[model samples]
Target: MKYNRLLCAGIAVSLLWVSPCPILSNEQNTSYASPAPAKGRAYYEERGDIVWEVPTHRKLIALTFDDGPDVSNTPAILDLLRKYDAKATFFVVGSRVEKLPHLVKREREEGHEIGNHTFLHSSFQHISRNKALSELDQGQASIVQATGAGTHLFRPPGGSYNDSLVKLAKEKGLKIILWSWHQDTLDWRKPGVHRIANKVLRNARNGDIVLMHDFVHHSTQTVEALKIILPELKKRGYSFVTVSELLSNREKPDGLIEVNK
Candidate 1:
């Protein structure tokens, strides 16, 4: 299938109407670093409670979609995953899960994993600790309510987190899940389909937890990008699996490569 170039061009222009959200800036591209003050992936990696990428020798990668269950984009993504016989993890916003429980249910039925993205997609850096806990609690609750299953994974909105937030996730038995730094597609910015696809194709590696979004406003760059990413990756002998599965196959420290960043 071909990317709709004209449609993407129009969406690129419409991107100007979108408000700024939590996105890592160019300056913050340090190997395992996050934006200022927030604990980088390495800090959590030392604690062994957060996962940016699994360390495994197998050609396995976990494709994760965040801020989703959107009517416009999610189903199309699910369709592509099904077409490629690939499994993915979706970090869903709680509010959207409540509104579109059916889509969440469909994700579960199709052998995909669901993780909590927070009740309102609020950044922990901006909210009080209590409010952040509530966001986590409610987000987890909504997923259980929608699918009768709870998630063990939690992704801080915009990849923003601190020491306390990481501790809190541990207290709740949720592992903080971040994306491989190189695998971020920036699809939320309405980058063209080729850019999005190339981001994944060029940087893809074993145990990569790819970051993509399904809740982009007035955009379908992600869905179109996957049209190229999935088949191409599969041809390269990469097997897509859920994050948990990737973790289960993690290599021992002796065999581990320092590529999770």
Candidate 2:
């Protein structure tokens, strides 16, 4: 039951791009499922192609935290972020934001950027088109209601997306934000802090988007790693930026760019 709850919440995280119509009542169609491994699928068939994780010559990196406005760990994470004088992105769940409006406000007041991670965080592929758009709209509404700010960026839950999903989000004036590299702190599994920290420290590079969660036990581990990683990267001449900031700085001609997705 505990695992099921987590899976449901995680799957519901893909609220962006849901259609506006009432959700259909059907367990097999509406219910969330465990993420299936798509490794053997073709690149286009796999969701990874929609994500970005590439190296560059610049001295910059973006740290993105997902699944919050958390009751646990968010305050501490914000405190640590403040202490380090570092700015990071938080891709918050819309429902969570409604519950923790103050946290969302605090995040915005502190000048950190927020991205929509959907209301329920449901699986994008599982939900209908109307549900997907509805989720994103609800998420945006919640963020504005909480923080009096608007977000132009979004990160699909489970790092998943499709052509229709992208089109829907873009039509709503949102950019589908996916990471290039992942930290996979697997904090959900209660991994050790040291292991999580080491993986991010060892793997992150310029233009890479490192994924971490701010809502669970392993979050502290990622935070701990950040304390070391942030300074070390600084020493190595790396500058940290929000995902939008990083994306905005990428050189482009005619202001036209491809969706990294």
Highest lDDT model number: 1
Q: Backbone clash tally for model 2?
A: 25
Minimal lDDT window, size 10, model 1? 26-35
lDDT of 2 at 122: 79
What TM-score, to 2 decimals, does candidate 1 have?
0.83
- Per-candidate TM-scores read 0.83, 0.74
Q: Write the per-residue lDDT of candidate 1 for residues 163-242, one digit (tens) a residue.
A: 76777888898988898999999999998999999999999899899999989999998999999999999999999999
Top TM-score hit: 1
What digit string (tens of lDDT, one per residue) describes model 2 on residues 1-261? 999999888888876557788765663364222244334224532433344643445767787888887776788778877876767889999999999999989988887889999999877867766788788999999999999988988888887765556667768888766665455656555577767777767776777787788876344665666667677767777777777777665533444443443
